[model samples]
Structures are given as C-alpha cells and as structure tokens.
Target: MNIAIMGAGLSGLACAITLEKAGIRPAIFEKRSQVGDRFVNGEALLSIFTHPDRDNIATFSDQYGIYLSPTSHIQRMELFSKNKKAVIEGHLGFSNIRGREQDSFEAQLERQTKSTIKFHSEETYEQLLSDYTHVVLAAGDGAYSKSMKNFREDFTVSIKGVTISGKFDRYTVMSWLDYDLAPFGYGFLIPYSEKEANLSIAIPDIPKNAHVHISDLWDVFYQKVRSQLVQNLPITDQFQITQYPIGICNSPRIGNTYFVGNCYGSMMPFMGFGQYAAILSGVYAAYDLCGMGNYEELMKPLRQSYENSLVLRKAMEQLSNEGLDRIIHSLQGDWADKLFQSHRINPLKIASYLLRPYIKLKNE
Candidate 1:
C-alpha cells in the first residue's frame, strides 16, 4: 500500500519507524529543512501522566522497538503556589530536549528510521491524498486537522519561554501556579543540563485571562524564579507562541487519512503533557494501516485521558489563589508521595472524576 506521512516531527517519525518495521516504507514529508527544526526547549515526561508504564523511554524501546535517551531522569519536582511550596522526590520521570539539537527526541527518532523524508516540501494534504493510498497527518499541531473539519478545539494557549544559562539541578524540575504571576496559567523550569534550562509559562485563552498581557506576566514570573532559585539567570534565547490550539480530533481515522500527534489531540489539556500518547498514536496508526489493529480502538485510552485532563483544566481555571495554595500545601508530605510515586493510582483520572461535580457546580 502506498502511504504518505506528513510532518517529520515526533508522531510522523514514529509512524515511519513503525511502518518500516512492518516492511512498509511510507513516504514522509517535512515542511522544515530537518526534523526538530525549531526553537530548542526542555520538556518533561511525567510518570504520573504515563502511568502503568514508568520509564517511557524503556517502554518505547521494549514494546515498540523505538529507543530514546533522555537528557536526565527527573528525580525531583518543586511545586510553588502563591503562598506555599512543595517538593516531591523520587523516580518522577524524565527531561528531554526538544527542537534542533542533535540529541533531541526528534533527532533520535529520525536516526532510527530508514524511510527517506522529503524535507522543505510544501505538499498539501489535498495534494498528497491524490497520490498516496493512505495519508497520515502528523503536522505537529491541530491546524491541518481543524482545516479538515476533524478537530474539536477545546482551548488555545499563549506561551512565552526562554533558554537561560544558570546553575541548575538537571534532575529537578520546578513549576509555579501563582495566579498573580500567570493568571490561570502556569510557569515551569525544565533543565536540559546542569548549566542550562528552559523557563516558560503557558496561559490559556479564556475571558478572564483576556486582559492578561503575557509579557507583563512573564516579567513577574522571571522575578519569582530569580527569587526562588536565588540566581540571576541570563537568558540566551527566547520564543513566544500565541493562540496555540490544544484539542482533539473527532476521529483518529477519517476515510484513509489518519491523524496523529498533536493533530490527534494527544496533548492533555491539564498541563500539556502528551509525548507518550503522541508517540503511541503514530504507532497505533501504523498498526491499523498494516492491518494489525484498529486505530480508533487503540486511541480510546488517550482520548479518555484528554477528557479527564479537560475536566481538571476547567476546575483549575475556576480556582482562586487560596485554593491553589491549599492544593500545594496538601502535596507536601505523604500525600505528594502517594500521588506522584504510586503506579497503581492514576491521579489524573481520579482528580478528574472527583472534580467533575465541582466543575459542574462552578459552571452553573
């Protein structure tokens, strides 16, 4: 079967690699000159988000024959609210570099694939459909899916981030949930190494946050990071994204065309963690194409996770600073350990179910 995969990002590359394993070398197309050709940033793979299977890298390698090396294992995570701070330590997850770096996840995946990618190509979906038997749209975002009338946009987020040079604990990641600094948004610091990290904030687009200027919020967040870390981190590079869509596809497969990655709505609405789900979507799509499995059936868990995360996101948006402070304080001791370290408990699902009534009440 002739197949074409769009956008050589995480999902597209994963799909290509999986297809190759099944003896199908699908044609891959990338709009950029190379894979991961964008701003460099640090991202986390939280074990809580990918429960039942901790150590995502190992899971990928062992289960799917996809090997990836993380920049560092996340052993500690610091959560800061407006009035309280909590530290949770253990085998949290991992931190990996994203974008143009040679060791980035995209580069790692690109190396594993034997399929040739047509880089710098402006092949549109409509154009590819006429040439290939099946087309997999993994364009790294929901734009193409939305254009195809297959995407249901839940929300958009404004993000501003920078790569800073500073002393950092590569295994520790920090996050801020203070509304004064980011409104209904959150700030994070994910270190790529002992001397470099990506500090960023993501603010959801809602009416209450309509007047929130990201630059102003960023200034506050930067100062907070400086005070908390007690370092004047020098920014080496910066990037800004506005109205970035976070949503899901109505269906994983529509006709012979498949949606994967962010295009498939693998990104969770709660904290935007979906690397595992995104990779799985691609592999699942490839499996469906090879007549090994059904794409829709494989994506059920990911879709459920998205729905759960959306519920939590709605609840979080309604919370006041006092509420956030209480939540952070509650995560201080044994509770934090149980919530983060326990493999049996899916915190996202539990939290979503518990907060559903509260969310409904708030909405009413």
Candidate 2:
C-alpha cells in the first residue's frame, strides 16, 4: 500500500514506521525542513513510560532504538499555596528526551525508518491526496481536514511557556509552584539531575476580555512567580522560549483521513502528554485502516482513550467556566488540584474513565 502521511511529527512518523514494519510503503510530507524542529523548539515534555508500548511512548523509543535519559526518580509530589500539601498517589512525570538537546526524537525516527520524508515540505491536503493511495492527516488538529467537517477546539487559556534547564537546588517538580511565581498555571522543576532541573512555567493568556500573547504572560507570570518562589535560582541558563496553544478539543477528528497527535486534539490541558494519546491513536488508525486486525477489537483501546479524554475534558472545561474561582480555591486546599491534574495528566485514570466509553463505542 502506498501511504502518504502529512506532518512528520510523532504520530505521522510512527504510523509510517508501523506500516513499514507491516511491509507497506509510506511517504511523509512535512512542512518543516527538519523533523521535530517545531516540537523540539516548542519544549515538548511527555510521561516516562509507566505503560506498555502498544500505545506507550517507551515502545516508540525501543522500536527506533532512541536512548532517553531519565530526568528524575520522582522523589516527591506535593502541591502548595498558602499551605503545602502532599499529593497522595499520583507521581511526578519526568522530563524526557524531547526536552533534551542531544537527540531530537523526530529526526531519529525519520533516519531510522529510511522512510521518505520530504522536508522543508509543503502542499495542500488535496495536493497531497492525489499523490498517494492513502493520505493520513498526521498533522494534529487545527488545520481543516477534508475528511472531517470541523476542527477541534482549543481548551485551556492559551499560554506561552518558557522552559529552562539548569542545576537547581530544588529536587522536585512541586518545589517551584509557589503563588508568587506560577499563578493561573503551574511550574515544573523537573529534575534532570540532583543539581540540574528543567524549570518550566505555563504563562496563561489574560482571561475573558484581555489581549495577551504568551510573551506577555511569560514576562508577568515569571516575574511574579520567581519573586515569590525561586528568587535566588540563577537565570543563567535561559535555554529557549516557545509558545504552544494548549487545551482539550471538543472532540477528536475522525473520518476518512486520520488526524493524530496534536492534529487530532492535543489532549493536553496540563502537563503535555499528548504523545501517549497520539501514539495510541496512530496504532489504532493504522491497524484498522490497514486491515491487519479485528476492526473493533484493534481499535477498542484507542477509541476508549480518545472518547474518555473528550468526555472528561468537556466536563472540566464546563466546570472551569462555571466555577473556576471556587475550583481553584478548592484546589488550593483539597484534592481539587490533584483531580484537575489527574483528569488530564494521568493516563491510568483516563483509561479507567473510559470503561463506559469502550462499551459505548462498541455499541455505536
């Protein structure tokens, strides 16, 4: 089968690799000259593989033989405000190879596959469609897909993020989330080393009726947060400043063409773990479309995960809009923050949340 994948990010590339493994030829169409350049420069951070590779990220690394360093052992997880509280169960997700400079994961995938990825590439969805038997819209949602009538919605208060990697005296990701610094959003002091950490803050756009970009938020939020929290931490290593529009989509885009990864719907309202969802979605789309397995059976997990994410995300967004102040205050004291974090960040919970989703999908 001749397959053309649009957008050479994780989802597209992974799909190509899977097809190749199945003895199919797939061509990648990328808008950027270099693979992962956008994602790399964008400061993407994902979960360390606690799940299996069927849709797990660790499987992707192993499949391609990409070596990733563990940034932290996840020593502690505690939320703080006026009072410091220890989160009961959910562990801290470590910063993975995506944040590291040495090996950009996208490039490695491209090189390993010998998959034809015409870089610095550009063409319309129609132009691409004419060229291949199958055109997988690997570009995550936002771009209009001919297969789908509408685009996914951006959920969070769009934010600009500045991530810096340097030696920090602080040990945990929670160490940096002080009111002085990361109000509106949070801070992650991901332990790259006992001494080094990836200090990141999500600077949110001004709410409701405000005109603000990420840079403005970064300036205001950083100054505020840093003044209260890490006043003494050296800003010596200001590595990169990148902005990503984050939020859950109203729904995942599914049609004749498959939209995976950021294109399908980022599925990241908190700590960007869209790659996991993206991977799983890619696997399902590939297997189903390629006619390799039971259509419903192969896609059960994938559909469940996506639908589960959508349902919870919609609920949370409604909750946020309806009573955000009260919710934030509650999170300040109780498990509200933990719940908020988990609803989006925790895949295990997400999977469990999908129990009914799978059943409903099977019914439909």
Candidate 3:
C-alpha cells in the first residue's frame, strides 16, 4: 500500500507530515531541488495564522506539530477610501519568513520529520497516478489537476513591494480602496517589525488590459504615501515587482487523486490569502486517505468561505468611493470582528450584507 504526493511545498509537506504521523510513508516528489527555492527572488508574504476560532493557525500547528513563527502581529487594521478611513482592531498579523533562509518553514517541517524528498522529479499527474496506490496533488499555485473541470481565469494581479526601513507600527496593517488605483483589487502594507515592512498592492486585470502593469500600481501607492493614508510608511529605493494568476478549484477530489492548495483552487478570491487553506487542505487529504473523513466535507467551511468572499468581492466592485467608505465604516464594529474570525459565511449573513446598503439608505 504505497502512496505518493507531488510537490514539496507547504501543501505537499503538510500532507507528507500528516501521513507520516499516521505511520504512513508517502513518497514526496518535487521538481525544485529545495523548498522555497522557486519564490526566493520575489517578495512573498502570507497572513499570520491567528483566527479567533478553532480554525486558527496555532491550533492547527499544535494539532499537526508543524511549527510556524510569526514575523509580525497585526492586531489593528485601517481601511481607506479617497475621503473616508476606518480602523478595525483584531488579529491580522503575517509571516514573511517563508523562503527567507535555507532552512525556513517548509525546510524545518522537512527536517523535523526526518523525511527525504525526491528532488528534481518532475513527474506529471498522469505519471504519478499510474505509480502509487493513492496520489495527492499538493502542487502550489497554477498547477492544476487534470480533473479540475472549471479552471477559469478569475483574476490576474500585479504585486510589487519594497522592504523599507522606517518607523512603522508592527501591530497594525493597512489597506486602501480606490477604483482608479486597484480597479477591483486593493493595496496593503504588512509590517514584519517596527523598523521594516513589505508594502505592496494587488491590481486586478479584470477587463483584460484594464489595470495594465506594475508601475501603475506603484504610482497609486506613491500617491497614497504622499497623502499619508497609513501615517509614515517611508519607502526606500529598494523594491521588486512580481505578478501571478490566482483562481479556485471546484472539486477537492478528482478521480483517485486528491487536490490540495493552489492546485485544488483553495486560494481565496478576495485578498489572495491561501496559505491557511493550503495547509488545511493537506491535512484533510491525509485524513481522507486514511478513511477518517471525506476531504470535501472536512473542507466545506473553507470552500464556503471562498464562495462567500467571491460574492462580497463582486459587491465591493459595484460600490462607489462613498459606498466603499460606508462599508469600511460598517466593518469597524462587531461585524468586522466576526467577519475576520470565521472562515465560512452563512446565508443569513449574506442576506443581511445584501440588504445593508438599503438599511443604511433608509436610516439616512
């Protein structure tokens, strides 16, 4: 009874670790020689796992024994429009340590398990399926399974960032909303420490050539900096730009192979946060392989959240600057807290959200 997992990324490593813990030895194959090698040149960032629920990163790490260190803790988030700004307080931290050193998150996970990965094994899904009893497609972003039926181009984003040295609030992360700047996207600053942070913006290329290039996103960011949207976030001359396509996968299981991470379309639609989903998908795949539970059922909340976020994003795109301001203002109270804590959204919340503008209009 041999099992094989493709890709040595967080998703693949996570699946391997889970299976290994269950006393199941799964062969791990990666095209790259080492973990995090593919993302070395770019400025990569992922949210710190601090959800205020059973689904938080810490709880998952403890349960699975995967150690993740937080570079910065964002307990406060400020939202902005051209004429409106709102501050919401809660857990919104992130980890920038991925692929930083030779031995980082993925590397540490590999080392802790004392497992060996078959590097340079660029085997395709068809090849693997013929080889192992069960296969897990934990491939990272853009690697789709053959069973992925609806692999549509949801959005393409140009992400450019700089590591600036200045006095920054380590506890706070900020986002700006302007249809002109991001179109259907947004800009943000995630500070890893008080002295430095990764400042970047995601501009969606929705209408094909609509949003255009990374320099345009930078121009918008410069304007925001001059306007002091996030107080004093000084930008050094040092920076790099990278772009990637992100989308979702409809089915968790495709044939005899189970999909995880970006390969399965686990990436969230709104903010491009997929690390949590990626890790959880790996865990769920392992459990399903062991007959503990169905991967689709275990991942229902995450899938639902992805769908809910898509609805919210579409609604946001329809809002005017003033409407965006009103929405940001509404997000400051208890609703904001609840919104970030839960991974999934229910029908009642969706209904209330749809009627929110009318309620506000009636109140006015």
Please give the TM-score that candidate 3 achieves against the real structure: 0.82
lDDT of 1 by residue, 155-213 (tens): 89999999999999999999999999888889999999999999999999889998887
The TM-scores, one per candidate, come to 0.98, 0.68, 0.82
Residue-level lDDT tens digits of model 2 in 1-364: 5677888776787677777766776778888766765423222233322232322235556754333334443434545443344442334344444522445556556665667888777787878777766677777655454235444343344434334444443334553333344444555555444444445565344343144444544565556545655554554344433344443323443335666666665455434457666655565557666787533454445544444544443343233322443433454533643542342455544534654343322213
| Candidate 2 segments exceeding 4 Å error | 39-73, 87-93, 146-148, 154-156, 169-171, 175-184, 191-197, 203-217, 224-256, 294-364
**Between candidates 1 and 3, the TM-score winner:** 1
lDDT of 3 by residue, 47-157 (tens): 322232323446666777776665555577778877777776665445444553554567666775545789889798778899988888877865465345645446556
Better of 1 and 2 by lDDT: 1
Highest TM-score: give the candidate number: 1
Arranged by lDDT with the best first, the candidates are 1, 3, 2
Candidate 1 Cα misplacement greater than 4 A, ranges:
360-364
Clashing residue pairs in candidate 1 are none
Q: Give, for candidate 2, the lowest lDDT window spanning 10 residues.
A: 48-57
